[model samples]
Target: MANQSELDDHYTRMDKIFRLSLGEKGAYSCARFDGDFSMTTEAAQLKKYQFIEEGCKIKKGTKMLDIGCGWGHFVDYLTKKGVDAHGVVLAKGQADACIKNGLKVKHMDSKLITPETFGKFDAVTAMGSPEHLCSVEQYREGKQEMIYNTYFKQVADLLPIGGRYYCQSMVFGPKMVKFEDIKFGQTDLWKKEFTDEELMDIICEVFPGSWLPYGKEGLINPASKYFKVVSVDSGRLDYIETIHRWTAAFTAFNLQKYLLFASFVPDYLFDKTFRRWMRRFKIQANLHVFTREIFEHYRIVFEKVSD
Candidate 1:
């Protein structure tokens, strides 16, 4: 694990890289990054709107809150369906884009929300945000319960009775590979080249500000306290598919950029090497799926119980 300063620096770099990768368009339009777009349109149609449609059963003219609405995709979807959709995002660029696209999205942190300021909604969704809460408590004895309990308490506060909450995140898989085993090597041919440690180090380096502390057990246990887990769905196949798409897209983009600039062969080689490793990682992710083991992505739907 990195020290506080190191982590801070790493997040700063990540923000820069993310901005570059996304450009002024803060939305991740690539179908692969978001399952709703990557999977077949029919599959996305079934799952993407499943939670909201189910929650709509509780109230008509429903007001929905998207806790970390990225580019207002869900909000747009809801608005079209005649639901009053509002969203909060920490990224200014994303907020701006959402506004420009005629969506009601605000730039705010989840912790800053209040009953008066944000108002209660029929539904709320974190969508992969809660896992970013800082904690090592899950690895300790009694502390684990305290840390996770507090998390659920906060979530419960934001929801009213009969309100629904939805979330998607990467959870601890059944097989916890040591941080060192998943690396692949740099070879011209298609082969796994780096070690798992190297991959984790790169991820840490790239996303320093991220805090992904919750595992499968940690998340479900805490959530069970305040909400009834209606369903838990795995999206590992989506992740594997997404990464492969990213590898291909980045490779193609790099090659095109190099060719346009000055025909830099070295850049092409670097991209090719990265694509090779990414392919291997995709295979490993798929293997986990086949085993019904731990998954990299999971979506949970919950209903708030009466206080």
Candidate 2:
């Protein structure tokens, strides 16, 4: 698992690139496009927030906390809907952006949050955050479930018995390849997923110290002790669609911005560790869905039952 500082640094380095490619809203998670394949990314994002609000039964005047809130997009949405929404993140870049946008966000670690640190809330959300909570090493060391249990307990502590918690995470799929066994110029994964192992190594460089859960069970079982799993939705296809849109966004960005990005291309090519992951990003989204099936995206809603 990434410590707070490492997570902050990763976001700091990638914030500008993210904003340039992901649009002004800066959503860094899978957008829900249940059936409307032609829906715009922004529209899909709205649908996702709506689903979360409805799924968690959030309404006007409800108190909510958005953990790992990126750029406060959802926080901004919830606030505009008359909900008392607060956000927490470890990324300085994101925190600054949130504050600049006049949002109620704190630059702090979500893991350290407790009732004492950030009062009780009617609901809590953690979109795209749980994937970073446990590392592959942690899972191998037999600490994944314990880590999740502790996290769920903390969330439960912040909510009343009937309060809700929403989470979206990436988990290792049924066909997940062993971390050590993954190779570039693949034999079975995909033909063009990566040109070489250096590109594969860049993924670690990009998301250093982060790892996803084995599967949804890795989350549900631990949370079962504190909350009831009310709903589970597989967003794998939606994520593929979302990434497709993101790639288009990157392509459609103004020429001036593209030129600016191009200036860094040489740097990426020269430094083996710079941005080799960019090449992987080209096919990774679709590859993960169609070929490798190594990762799965899920949205789950939970309600506090007992501590």
Candidate 3:
């Protein structure tokens, strides 16, 4: 699983820009456009969150735990809807921002959460977090499935038999390159031409300490020990649109964002690692994988069915 520092390498690096573009409570996950890419980014994100709300049967006064809550947007939304929502975030910048906004968020690992720590939530949601449940090292050591099983078990323990858990994650697609073929950091960033295998490396640099499941089935099978799958759907196309919109937001003219960008100029110019990291964003390797189906997205609702 991605340690706190690894997760922050991505989330915290973009904290200021994300806040400036999406506001203090904006979401960072894929939005649900349902094949209609015309909707504004904000609208689409809210739509996706509402879908999770309905799918989980959340209502006013419903107690919920938002696992890996980024920026506390969904938690804030639930609070506004009268739901008693608490969030657990691993990233320091994210937790600080949430608390600054008076949100009920704890900067702690969700895997450590138990009934004793939080009592029990009426529902649980892990959006875009499970993808980080198994690190590359764990996957290589053949511990991926075990890591996944542990995640499902933790979530299962946090809910009742009928409780719902919503999860959204990315999985490898048919076109995924062989893991061995991925030259994770050998390729020069300035190279104008590259192969899919090399692109996978850039993607790794973009999201280190993380590895994905094979597909929706990879997630479902591990979860089968503790929950029954209630619903599952592909959000690949929606994620493509979401990425496009995000690119627009990040590149759009904003005084705050410009200031943030300016602050990074010194490091970007002198720090090779930081410069490389910043360049990784320009490759849009994530968008590449999704567009080519090298990675698939899934949204699911699982009902607790076992201990």
Top candidate, metric TM-score: 3
Judge candidate 3 at residue 8 and give its lDDT: 94
Model 2 has a clash total of 0
Q: Give the Å error, residue 110, model 2.
A: 0.6
Instruction: Tell me, by lDDT, which candidate is best.
Output: 3
> lDDT tens string, model 1, 1-307?
1233433342232332333443323323222224454465334433556654674342347877877676676777778778888887665556666787788888766656776766778778766556444433233233555655776676677778767887766665654455335342322234345334444434433333343543656677877878888777666666665545444543444443444435434554678644443444444433333244433667778888844
The lDDT per prediction is: 0.55, 0.78, 0.90
- Candidate 3 residue pairs in backbone clash: none
The clash numbers for all candidates, in the given order, read: 13, 0, 0
Q: What TM-score does prediction 1 earn?
A: 0.66
lDDT of 3 by residue, 1-307 (tens): 8999999999987888899987889898999889987788888888988888988989999999999999999999999999999999999999999999999999999888989998988899988988888888888999998898888888999999989999999999889889998876798987776688888888888889999999898999999999998899999999998998889888999987898899899998899999898888888889999988999999999999889
Task: List runs of model 2 lying over 4 Å from the truth.
Answer: 8-10, 179-205, 275-277, 280-291
Q: Model 1, stretches more than 4 Å misplaced?
A: 1-46, 55-60, 135-147, 177-192, 246-295
lDDT score for candidate 3 against the true structure? 0.90
The ten-residue window of minimal lDDT in model 1 covers 24-33
